[model samples]
Target: MPGAHGGSQLPLFSLTIMESVLDAIHARYAPVDARVAEILENIRRDCRALERESRNQGNERQVEEFIDRLRAEFGERVVIERQRLSAWAVRTTRWNYLFTVRGDSTDRIVLVAHYDTWRGPGADDNTTGEEIVKQYLLADLRAARRPALTHTYFLAGSEECGLVGLSSQLLLALGLQAANLALTQQNWLWAVVAAALAPLAGYRFGVSGSREYVKTLSTEQLRRIRGVVSVDSVGEGRLYIPRGTLGADFLHALIPFGDYDSINDLLEEAAHLHGIKYNNYLAGGTTDHVSFLEVNNGLWVRGREAARRVAARLARRPYTPPLRVPATALVAMLPGKASPLVFGGKIHTPRDTPDRVYPGPLRETLLILDYFFHRLDGGARVGEPRNLDEFHYARLYRTAAGHLLALKDAVEPNRRNVNGVYRATATVEGKRGIATVRDLVGWGVETRLRDQVAEICAQLGLTWERERIDELEVIGDDARLHFARHLTPFQRLAKASHRAIAAVQSVVRNWIFLTFFALAWVLAQVFGWALDVAFSLSTPFALWVAEHTVLTLIAVVAVEIAILLYMMARRIPTWIDNAYRHENRADNLGSLRRVRDQTLR
Candidate 1:
């Protein structure tokens, strides 16, 4: 390598000294390709062996054996914790292994890999991740100098089954039950009910393991964490640096997680510097990194407080304030050769064997990670706290408001025609007459249009501030007008009727008094006879109803089921239309843009 600094070549003697230093640095953590291959093979073999043992005994035996192996390899530095998780009436125990490497500074870099496999040998799915972490640890152990940042390797179990291990641990550590965390103090009764149902809710939500270990950490220790990198499925194919979990925009809006952009930027820089080919992806499914990001951000506390305020207002109860936590948390991941949008390859299949994974890509991935860790440990900036509310506002403004504007423009000619007709039909003969009524109706329609626009914006998570409504008025008219343009004249009239109906429904849906009135009407028409029958014990009809109790119960159940089906039929079409629109918007917005082959000189 040339010894140059800022375009100035060094003296021959200085060049020689620089070469020696560079050679020493390279030697410190250089991984032999053959050795890496051998380690991966051994891991696959061990997994297969334990899997056989599992068949003889139970699946827990395989998990235990894997834990024992970690203890043997990492020795005293390894700490293991057991977690109990229940899902769908089946209870299982999973373990999380932590391998701590002390360094000069308390600031730490956490690396995670899930060792649990799905249906198969799981060689490419996660054996590669385990090998990568193990190699990094071995390299650190062998280096002459202590690392600048402490490194913690978190080996998570049971990631395949809906993040059970990850979510359970995080919830436990945060002193939260899955359901009650979303309830407020004003909702004490509801909170109690939620708590009682937490276990079943937790299981359905796939809550289960690493957070238990996180809970054990002191506040100082937690704050010292610099970044978390989850290594997964890197045995073959192209390397990918995942930014976040895909299709989690809704969950993220409610409970903000720390941004991973900084970590992603660093990964790209490191890969380019090391001449590694890679892609930036939003992972289709989540990994262990999600747990770390969610725990560190602490925005769930703020979200719960907002929920509490709303609950208090609704119930006319005293509000309880929420504690604030800083949202500067960073998390990133390196997934093995896989599709970002769909599950591709032989992952979770019996065909995901050792031979399927290539050593060349594995070694390359390790090198890229090595460079990434070095840069990160050198005090590179890792995270930027995001304003999630602002992000949602911008997105809504762009997608919903932009569409509304486009639709408004598309119907501009029609609006002009209608205005022209109103102006032309005005007669000054006797009295205002037809023109006066038309003008009044037109004014009402215009007012309703603006209000509807504001209401739609509010429903989409934007504040109904006057300035924002004014901005929308400037940009476009009501969204219904835009959508109505695509319909035939009769269809457009029908749409107008539908809008009127919807407006009335919205009033009844939103106002507590109106909702109660509607409920009372439904009870009077549908359930009053049943209640009357129960009350009139002395009547012949009541005696007949008591005689055929099972038949009456079945009839009531059938009616309820029929009502549910009708409601679903009315909603499903609208849901599908919205889904298509969202997909189209995503495609137009370039959410899946890729940066490829941009290596630095």
Candidate 2:
């Protein structure tokens, strides 16, 4: 079970022997699903046919021929479209081909690959990926019945030139989705992006292209997405699943690498004359699936909050708003291998000739994808799939209470430290890790701890920046530790709710204070005028305090501080009471029966 869901409790290993054992198991195994074997055979035939047509010809002509052949083979399942790109007034167009198989479910799994090469015949770089994706598409089309999940093939052009074609295609999709206002509906089950899956010798797993694509998606689009699987460079007779988040970087971390057991199961079952060899490791690089991991996790939630705030203001309702809850979790499945060092080195060079390509890797790659498709159709979630405990609750009572205690200890009764300073330097360690708050007071300690956690997230490559902790911010999502089994999504949601409520209260309270000050000033002016007429008094100072800008600013500051102090004095007891109550509830919620009993009571 260590590798069942695509992770292991044992440390990552790169030993050749381990790779050999796994490969041997795969080669001897027989597929449990008859359809998987049938589809693999179809993939083999298509790959062979495609290989025979390879030549160091024009890129456009090659792409066109490939598209034509696919359309002819798959019939109505195939659709081809062209998109234009412009830079500095220079324009260029690339073709995008799609093959769709509709199913009973609205959830769709999209497979992507590029058809163009950087130079030469680009056999290993993408030809293999293209054919593999096409084969899967054709197999699904030829099936006697529809699978439970929809499968879409997206064959993009100009990928070798800098992913231009894929970029255009994604933007076009988003534009269409926005125009149709389909953000609320579930659309993507996951996306599998393939490139360089036929490399010889040692293979590297890369998902940089996928990451780029994910980075472009809006938060709403991201929410519907479950995961991204990258099928790249499978030719080395070995299967590898890099740490999902790091993609290629997992190789560089000197950590052991392993494959998803489900994928491995299919590979083992489908192996023919060739054996699959692979070792998961740590290294960093980019691939198309990286886009899946880079999706904006909380943008939609924030937009909804903004909308609620506007509605609340119009309705004159209390500003307390619901917390953000993302529709999907961050899960990326990176299948093993890109071109081995030897094969990849020739990719962009003229040496990338037809002779460098082979059929063995292509065949193995197809089998792996075939099994993956079957599993998806059977309803298995990949890459950090959540369970009931994760969805319903979190063990954050200790963490939260500890944080509160730290805040309480950071301040003296007078709100200053022994050094007569309101701020202190402190640190706290938790289930996640250690965090340091430098030069912080009671309230500042809370802020500093949050900031430090965010900083740690950046160092671990969990966030785009060091300050923003989006919905997917968690240790378990890390490509290395995806098997940790517990996540704190609910705890984060609760914190976000509390933060939002506090922010609204602050704004409304400030507005109220300013309104009262303005009213008092107006009344003072009227009284001053009445006194001026009733008694001959030199009240220039009183008038100047109202008229002079500096005097007015000083008066406002004094009033604001007084208001803030009064509010804090009034709220401190309430805050303490709530904190204790929540801590008690958290402790009680840890046990399922206790939670139910408490509810009943």
Candidate 3:
């Protein structure tokens, strides 16, 4: 009822295209084409089955039943793969069920949802999610023309048990697949989709599953995931968008958490039309995206003692700081109500039955996802996503752009702005170096920039920081850059030593002449003592003694001056050598930083 009247007011051209696609999906076809009734019926049947399934008994009969139902419903289109779990799953196994519908291209949009329940008949917990996947699969199959991207429906098991099904079963397989494809196809992009439980008054977003799934992937595997959509608890009191750490490079959308899909759609349209935009958003909560950041960015904090021990081993420094995951890789979709309550009052309880679930919210979620997929498949344009009227997109874009440009100035000397990001490159005496800098929060336009910046820094031998450098308003935008400085501890030490050496050299070089004068003065006094010891003078012979003392003093002073000059001369070369060594280290560091910056830019 909420989204029904809230039509997506897209641009006229896109709206026309969207309507055309929607019409086609609703059109009747031979051998029973896709219909809204089918979706509603499937939802009801799944909810009934879920209510009856005995998942808590641990016999795993429900898993088999669900698998059988899928096979019977889709025939050969259903493919089940057994996934062995780690110790984390507590010996529970996972079965990844996939239903694929080929399209005009090999690029896939994997829509996934879990089937495990906590304690009771989990209807709104996930029955809605299962039904949605079924609807999409059927619609894809019945379509006369193939869509732009391939559609894969993955119903994962063991999700209720610490995300073992999603992490080990689905993400691992996808990563392996992407790795294999990398040898031949470098541009392969895939998206994983999932929905969190809904129906609680305040609870309408659950993204932990999707977040953890992406975290388990290696970098190569992560590169293949271009997008991720999480459909958390929906059909609640107020529709809003999700906001937090989402693991994907592009096209991250979440439905009904706070209704982030609408925001995602608007950003995409704007990005596609205009160039990229940049800004900062909170990496506030946990979701499947957090896992992606973990795998890619190594974002975890060790215990203080453990970190101390590690730092001691590495550099005698013992502060194991919490590692901050770069926000660049998280193209998050934060859409849903602002309320934090994701599960309705009955979730995981005995009362979480079919009666608790409502068709109104379910239908609204179904339409949103339906229109989204069709849009991805080049569908008829409808209206824009909900809640765009409140925010100022143009101002945000302008501020972000200005902030991006200002990063070059802020990082100064070795860094320069390039392609809407900052790059540091330089070369000294044939040795090259490089690094890149981008927005730390990675809101838009520069989603992948920060991660890429990390990669270049690693390649160019620059020290990388795990957190943002600083947070200050830049050009009226909360522009933050990934904190990276080209100096390591060794380099910093070398720089200090170089300064000390230079100071010592200046003093020694000036003191060389002063040393001769001081030695002559000392020799004059020594000659006077010699004169007193060699000649005992009476009252009449005092003048003679004085004359002899003067002559002896001059001779001794000349000899002492010569000797001191020789000694100081011998030591000057060694002092010069030490100075040169320290200077070389300092110069090399500066050169390396410059070279790195130059190469990257």
Candidate 4:
């Protein structure tokens, strides 16, 4: 058959031959078998003890021992390397074991699994993933002939707490500075603050590890990459594939990143072709495959720009764009269960022991991956890239609508108190009611909307400024008038209430200064009264004239100056707001066009 690479004929394998090979491998390493069970138990015991003691050193030593064993068994066929990562005041060491089966081509297929545990035995969370990698390597070694592709087995560390090990390696490979992945006290504080004030501030904290990981790959390497399959939590239940980093629609709506559409399609195709019963859906939670998807959809750059803009606004500084890296999509996954928001419920707890993992799913996962790898080795491409602008714009609009609906529900509870006003302001035809905080939020959901619109416009080869949208007549005066004119009496009451409160606050602030002037006038009167009584007794006309005329004029001038200063101080905030708005209004065409060109290509 025709192949994707240089029109070269692709290698095809019979189903019977593939199944026979996978069956032989599965029989020996099935989770219930004595040999495999023993290995898994040992891993669980070591990881559980080390995690309890908080000893990453022990974990490193354990991983090193595993690598040493592999080296001894495979001899020259397996190449091993150790990578030491330092980030966030912590140091970690991870290993990469490459199993070379010299092929006609130089393309590489990467299989990844993290060996570290969060807590408990972690038999299902990741011990299953590690064992799968080892079993696959063994099968590769025992094969009588060379395979069609080279395989790189990346056994990572520190994945439970953060994707530090994987992210650091990717960063260093692409010549970028590795970020601090440690969750510090300050990070936790900000997380709390962000959660508490999320409604009003509309800010999200931290960066995606997957996004950073993808950004650290060069263009050539990305092109050469056949696929990156992450094996995680496959010890129990059926084989499952998640759509992207965020498995659920709500989570994706809130913070959209990563795009695994192409990879997911490939995996499903493989399953169907092999007659493997597998579960595929928009599952919840994340795994290492996310790193690839984040770059595939171009959401990582969007996220980075959003964060940079928020920081620049807060710090009152100009935002300078960071370094750029080329991107692609070649990530897939192997996991257990088919839950919407979780993989294995026992994970991260003591219940996640080896006994909870079923042998059937483990065997099925291995089969699926074997089929996927072989298909990729045959020079199969993951199809054309998705239109990221269309994808993101649809999600943006949906999320905005969701937020408005939620706001409406919150206000509905208090409707009875304002029912009369609501009726009074109802439209003549009664099709629409009044404007609440929801209307305000919907109209002002500008940050992501503006960014997405700018991106879409740039992709169309049009020069667009953010403020230009607001200038359009359809959305300008007409929309505002329409919203105001049809407001239910309740909405008008709410709006009037807001204005009244603001006006009261303004008067109260001015009155504070006015009180000082009043106090000064009273003091002057008292002093003048005392001076008059004393001067009358002593017959001093000059002192009495100075107190009545010059002193009084000086006090009046001082009060007037104080009033002027207060008025100017009130305008200071407005000046700052206007300046910020103006800065953002600058045409974003250049940067957006470059991004569009780079990502779409």
Local accuracy by lDDT, each model: 0.46, 0.38, 0.40, 0.43
Runs with alpha carbons beyond 4 Å of true place in candidate 3: 1-44, 50-53, 56-79, 90-93, 161-221, 246-295, 300-344, 378-601
Give all TM-scores, in the order shown.
Answer: 0.46, 0.37, 0.40, 0.43
Candidate achieving higher TM-score, 1 or 4: 1
Model 2 TM-score, 2 decimals: 0.37
Across 32-68, the per-residue lDDT of candidate 4 in tens digits comes to: 2444455556656765666555544566676777778
- List all candidate RMSDs to the true structure: 18.5, 23.7, 28.2, 22.7
Error of 2 at 234 (Å): 2.5
Which structure is stronger by lDDT: 2 or 4? 4
**Candidate with best TM-score:** 1
Off by over 4 Å in 2: 1-60, 69-75, 78-82, 85-93, 161-222, 244-276, 282-284, 297-345, 358-360, 379-601
Write the residue-wise lDDT of candidate 2 on 13-47 in tens digits.
Answer: 23212444334333322332343334335434433
Give a tens-digit lDDT track for model 3, residues 334-360.
222221233334555555555545544
Predict model 3's lDDT versus the native. Answer: 0.40
